[model samples]
Target: MAWTEAKLIAEAILEGFERHFRLFRETTAGAQARFEQADWPAVQVAARERIDFYDTRVGETVALLRREFHLRDPSDTLWRRVKVEYMRLLPQINQPELAETFYNSVFCRLFDRHYYNNSYIFVWPLISTEHLEAEVPIFRPYYPARDGFARVIARILRDAGFERRFRDMRRDIRCLLLAIRSRFPANRAIQQNFQIAVLCAPFFRNKGAYIIGKAINGADQIPFVVPILNDPEQGLYVDTLLTGVEDISNVFSFSRAYFMVDTEAPAAVVDFLRPLMPRKGKAELYTAIGFQKFGKAEFYRDFIKHLRYSSDEFMIAPGIRGMVMCVFTLPSFPYVFKIIKDRFPPPKEMTREQVKEKYQLVKMHDRVGRMADSWEYSHVAFPLDRFSPALLELLDAECAGSLERVGDQLIIKHLYIERRLSPLNLYLHSADDDDIRHAIGEYGDAIKQLAAANIFPGDFLFKNFGVTRHGRVVFYDYDELCYLTECNFRDIPEAPYPEMELSEETWYTAGPNDVFPEEFATFLLTDPRIRKVFRARHRELLDPDWWRARQASIRAGHLEDVFPYPVERRFRKDREEFPRRYPHLADG
Candidate 1:
């Protein structure tokens, strides 16, 4: 039977949809079974395999449509018809949810849109590390033969009215490449198969800047650049000709742009490019930046220079645990810097390696910096030649004396510095009743904001938080920070006997991720007054149901709006309402 072109295309799309759904169902079921069995490693492997299968299947589906139906153009009428047909057929599918997802996935590719619109653009230089050895080197532009993907991307940008800008920026990028090559030459063959891609992203303009360098490979393929709206403010700082790749590249308006190098990049390369990155130390003196390290020289020159202290006068804070980094105050600076100890004293029944691993994980969390409104971070280095004789002598007397020295340089590991609170602790040592009430309220608000941002402060202890000068509570400790979604929110399993409830261990088999939000009341609200206040104001936080609802909302892609500023700055009223309130404004 001869079928019309439209009918043939619709039938092909449906077949592709079914193929995708079948594969998805099989993979999901297998992965789910592994997850239920608590075989996380197997689950991870399955998840990766599923993604690979999906990509291959989608590519095939796209190829089939292009080859057989000749439906190449995204803006083609046939694409629209296919979408309409999929919607009509969705209800008839045995697995409607999977069908809907399949439709969205194909539709997004056909329509030239991303499934998830990421805020950052990752730019990787394809140059070999060995070739980077030239005193001045120029990198050749190498576009891989990838099924006209580049041409398609160019066409999309052209249709968006950004072709000219993209071309201009590409030319500038070539110039930057030439500059980098000439400045740093390598002696060895530049044969590193994968090089670090420079991460360029826009962040809040007013917030502090942070950068981290680490080598990562063998994960996922890099993403293509997408067009963004132009922000006038961003253009002033970033050389559009140098960094801009059309509208998709214009990101500075929403936040400052950051240029980060990969750890594999030579120190010389990083040093040369340092000036091009955003300036560090922009936050207030009281603001703390987590997960920072500085060379011995840099620690003294850049950080210690700003701090005024005689070597003899440096006093470490009391009650320092192996897990808790040593904190010291500076007369010149309002904030105190925390230096992680080389080895943490192991807790009972735990090996030294385990304690070290736990500490390392905490440091890793600090580096990720996901907690909203948390402390800022920066990497710094000081020169040994610049240190004064008095400073050198002081370093000899204090804990700095035992620091690991490399040649003439001392490595300051993961320094977290924040504003020194008056009481030095958020848990009120001798605050009035009203102050305690205010502190608890602020703490509740902090928890809500963290939850909204998908962060769960693993340890909900009051000592883990600090009160800022403005009386706002901020979480400072990150040893136990984990994603709220990662936790299995559950009600405590009931015990067969009443006496069993008093036992230290649980009767039911609890997984590593299981969390009982209800227990927070007993753990955090030890004080009677604080408990009463928390129960009256933020009682919902103690309910596991609330957490589960939030997790579901997040899974369904509901993002709670979290603002950095105060409520008054939000301008909650409608623009039309403003005109009604002031008729004179309308006349103007």
Candidate 2:
């Protein structure tokens, strides 16, 4: 027979309860007999045996409903009753913030156990990691009803109840503190009135207009003190969110706009946002402005210009937050975009704030051009035409030939001379060459310099390094250019690449007692021709153990702790404690 609406709803509720029970059984090591044989009230009484984390509060609530309501399958009906009880008991928790945090955390954890395998641990996302996708903002593990219930409860709390509670707080000190501690910034105004309802509901629900008049008369302060924006059309209040957070670029808003700063953003990203703007005529002119400002000619002459502003080198462009994102721009030979920020900028320096604010204007302008992704504001792709000439000047001094730029990206074309001492030589190390060992040595030294400047080959394979036509060694593909501090050079082992043998997490083995050891020999000897070069210059790469030693030095001190943004003024406390905590590396 086809099920009625009530039966369908009941089945969903039953299934959700069954999943929770199965999860509990799995968690407690299949100890269903222990639970079944025990008194539900007594279980809760035993849980409160100590003020420790999980007592029988859940069981107590379950037992109360089963006995009072004459209910069977209490688990299926308990959630709604428990939410009511949770709402009722809010006035008593010592630290309501801590209590609410515990409630939400336990709620999610319990549901997670029902849906996810214990073997697969959840990974905490890092800074700027993506948030829930647009399509699915929240998940309802047990069925859609429970999810609907929570949202409805929150909405009720926000809409009709908060104002009266804030006004009459003096009548009940405990409930007043509970509201303060919950600190629900999002819906404070509405929740305040709800707090008053929670306080008087048990006794006053049936009381006539007199009690309600008294509650209103007792209210001296105006309600709705906190301003909350619930409208999606207005978007997030950027300034309020960004005020203190310095690392804004990696934030959800910025990363979602990644296509905005990358070479491959969708056309709709620009087109859809265009209508929101007031002025339309300036679109083409904006692109022309950026092209002229940081154009190819200007970039070459001021390649190292960013370094002069190193002390104040951070940018504060508008992002998701009211706080500006920190930025670092480099006009170096290859051109680089590094994000630099001081989490806390000096309040006295309004000028610095203004400069960063300009970046938002740049982003706004680029958004109109549809070049927002790779326009100068976001860092344009390398201008190969301007770059090739300077590179060739460096390489030709050591070669019989020169190099040329192809399009806007750097790529090798005239690969004729075999033994030429060009900078691009390292990439062609595997190619036949006279004095192959000597060629390898030049290529290796050049790579070492590039590595020092915070650039490393994406593929450390010997073939990836190459000699340019001008006889200089140059690195090309920078898609995975690692931060210099993150690379380990002296330890290039000959073993199969770690990525090949094991997963990324389990691959690296760091011995507790092992001092950093230089192991460049293993890498150099991975191939015969390279091995010959390693033996020839065994001193430079191996002696001081440049890679291992430098890495240890970088990791040992505050250098490793430098964030992408400028140092915050608030970190003075951390700085003071750093030397005391890390005595051995204190001087560093």
Candidate 3:
């Protein structure tokens, strides 16, 4: 009777996962229609909606278990049997790793935090994904030697199955051939095995569809991405050709929303994509393709492996301390853990619930290549011995409500994990003149991009942003963030007299949502050198009229195009074209 009950519980969880995956695939399959019709607003809505699918399904399954067994917390003996039965059901599952995460989620909600291990949960994957492959091949191969180079490129585009026709196939093909020729090695050692292999499906995001693949000779191969854009009036055209690792990595950046691509075996797709972007882990690749739950599972397994190999204490991240959160990072790890403080100091007026809502808003809205994505975790633990004395002290002082000490382990009830970056304020402090100019340019770009996406970072202080290894400025603080549409952009009121302008007291009334852009330089760009560079390049940012115009455009549903690559990388940008845009590419 006990074994039968355990099997019933395990089967119920697996059935719930199946329903989620089916709906997930159906929702993803709609991207093609959304792209073909040039419905960007629909695309954005779909992206946000898909993120909620997992939690809804989990809730339903948990409710079912409660009604059936009145099981608030089951005995350890019974739950262990459930885990064993769950493993038996995974061999034939298409996404075994994903199913394991679903099981863990259901189990964790009902069980205590102390049992969150291999005994009652999937601390490690039950199935081996290392050798997984699709029932149907994920990619199609084309032999350039047999079909000729130009024909093969044309064939690649046709095989992608785009509904829209190319505006100028001949010109675009020539541009792609030119770009590929520029990347080929100088030595004349052409191999007979030269071919191009591209994924059969298009990677759809926002207003563009990408063709992902690699070009190979015998010993050398380079990854490539061809971005296909619908010009509405001009039809479809290839915008640019991105070759090599750095270019591909930027297109699949952590800051961007996940791409919608159909794949039965996501593990195989990730495996095939590993060599192209070797720096990205399986966790990020899975997340990029829209399997966020499995990505979280993969991240935990990787973290466990990292903890065993490295010997580093958790330390407070170096920067100006945050007002509303306590953050720490392991010295050997690339990510940071952030917890909301039990109390906020003076001038910081918001509840902890409001801060969490801001974080969730960032998660659902399009990041627009400016905001960083964070993983929310609850009841996570670490060994007491791994913490530095100072970090432990800070946590004890600030995060008492969110933390607990169980035996030798410190468990955090709620926290967020994100990729660590050098704070922009600290980065500019020691940077040279040239670096400062570049960073200032990126800082302005980040603000403009986020504004276009309707996100307003309420606080514009330098400390609220960070600089990535790629030299891009990204906003990570979200406590005061709100939609741009919600803000009231207005100019400061004129003083009745000159003396009034110099008064320290308020000269005019201000609302909660009102923002005066003209006052930004006074507080943020205090350094003379930083002020000069910013004013020269981004003068429009300080104009109230300019902000009003952007708000109007967003309200009118004008979706701005935020390119992944630079203007110099584009095949055509008004009068400037590729090769001519770059100093090195001028002669080519």
Candidate 4:
């Protein structure tokens, strides 16, 4: 029988759905049997099997469509039909929770194609607390997915020509006076008009329902609500508008709940709520307020004394640039804080260009603040003023050579507060034989994930990476971070003569940014025992070919999965093998 293009697409989608249903049935049956026997480990193993099965099939389906139909866009009707077919199978699944997981995985894959390719927009709707409770029955909100959803909505609105309409209406001659008074109560009028325009727009209102349904059903997740305002009247007004939408009210009613802003701005409806946003320096604000309002006077006095006079107050480690940012642990605080000064105290003999480079390196830390957070990197940074008088005094004294005294607030370069982990480096100088083996294995895995993320720790010093509380190695130093793709990975050229090989300097001229991955092991693994272990386990990292291949895959847009949790939390096929292999670290 001859098939039209649309008919062929429909048949393909149905075929994919039938395959999904069969796999779902098989996996769930196995899982349910395990569940009945109270075998949680077996149940998890089954769940992983289901997920992997679905993942492989879905990938195959996508590839088949691409090859046969030349399908490229995720927003194509083919996905819509697939989603419809999947929904029909949802109620048929034996377990409701497992069905939800299957739906999330499929939807995530579909949405990710458009999202990563910059073809879709997601808008986040701010719901009232009451509506949030009603919409989200299960309370498992994934922040990253929710954020991505909002971004997609925002993109949709901009693409649908709603942005121009909203802008024109806001700037209309009729609303000119109100627009001028927008700084005051008249701001409410402008905001209301914009909301009304959005509600009346066929594209937005129609798409709004689909967006809300996807957020509600695709994952057991909900968008984070804006902070409730201090003023009761204003708060109630915003809350009403959020849930006032007849189409999206149900999804939100069941549940209770920067820098990239240029690329992913929120939809105009949500944009109106920007005035109520809290200041970005929330950590600093809360810390300052807590010390001022709740701190004891005597405790502050004693803390100040310790900061000024304690013999233990010394630089934790020497900085590469001679800039005075050092880690210090106080009895009052459980974590270690790195206090950086405003400027590097220039060396007396340093050239102007050298001083500029040092300053730029210091500024690079701030730039890295916006990069993706990984277990390998520091997560947060706050101002020095957030600390109490005692902490500030200690910081002032400890960072004396690096510190620049400013009027009440001492100007600092960048203050980084990080969790204090084990003092021993991955080199395992002080660790036992068993720990040395474990550290080497853990470090190898950690570096692979970091490289996959496109981050290269420019400096590979053992001191820069420390073993965490769980024996995982994490790179804390941000000063030498460079994109993995930015580096040129190549083998060292041969030395012309034996005398040249013995020279301290390189025979070939090297650019400032040029890095040879081949030299990493020699430069980092100085200890004989550590070198032996690393060579045995992670010899691939020392080869330029390996680095080049990984970089090429990344450049081709292949993203490897990197989980935040430990291996035990991961649903691996060989769940029983992990405990036996790393018995001491397996539990964590």
Question: Which is the leading candidate under lDDT?
Answer: 3
Residues 1-588, candidate 3: write the lDDT tens digits: 878999998999999999999999999999988988899999999999999999999999998888887463555478889889999999887788899999999988777876787878889887887666546588999998898878898899899998878887866777777776666655767688888889888899888899999888887768999999898887888988998898898888888888999987788888878899998999999998898888887887899899899888999999999999999999898898999999999889999999999999998889888999888889888888999999999999999999889999888999999989999999999999999999999999999999999999999998999998788899999998999989999998888888988878868888899999998988988999899999998999999999999999998999999888886777775224544544453432
lDDT of each: 0.44, 0.30, 0.88, 0.41
Output the lDDT of residue 273, model 2.
23
Q: Indicate the TM-score of model 4.
A: 0.40
What are the models' TM-scores? 0.44, 0.22, 0.96, 0.40
Query: What is candidate 2's lDDT per residue for 460-498, written digit by digit as tens?
Result: 444334343334343422223344565544342444664
Rank candidates by TM-score, best first: 3, 1, 4, 2
lDDT of 1 by residue, 343-448 (tens): 4454433443443444444332322122212222223233444444554444444435245455555544345555454432434767778988898887888788
CA shift at 245, candidate 3, in angstroms?
1.0
Taking all chains together, the TM-score of candidate 1 against the true structure is: 0.44
lDDT, candidate 4, 1-588, per-residue tens: 222554564455445655765765555434323322334345334433443454576676656666787554556654445444444543432222223333333344545322322122111111122232233232222222334423333333343222112322211212222222232352232221121112111111000111111123232222222111112122100111122222232212101000101101112222222122222122221111111111122222334455555434322432232243456555444345565543446433334345344433322221111121111111122234445566556565656654555444444443444445554462466777788878877777667767876677776766666664445576655555667888988788899988998888888877766778777876768878778888999999988889889899889866453433343422222333434644553433
Clashing pairs in 3: none
Q: Give me the runs in candidate 2 sitting further than 4 Å from their true place.
A: 1-435, 454-458, 487-526, 538-545, 552-588
Per-model tally of clashing residue pairs: 22, 45, 0, 27
> Comparing candidate 1 with candidate 2, which one achieves the higher TM-score?
1
Q: Where in model 1 is the C-alpha error above 4 Å?
A: 1-302, 307-312, 318-324, 345-402, 405-427, 502-509, 574-580
Q: How many backbone clashes does candidate 1 have?
A: 22
Ranking by lDDT: 3, 1, 4, 2
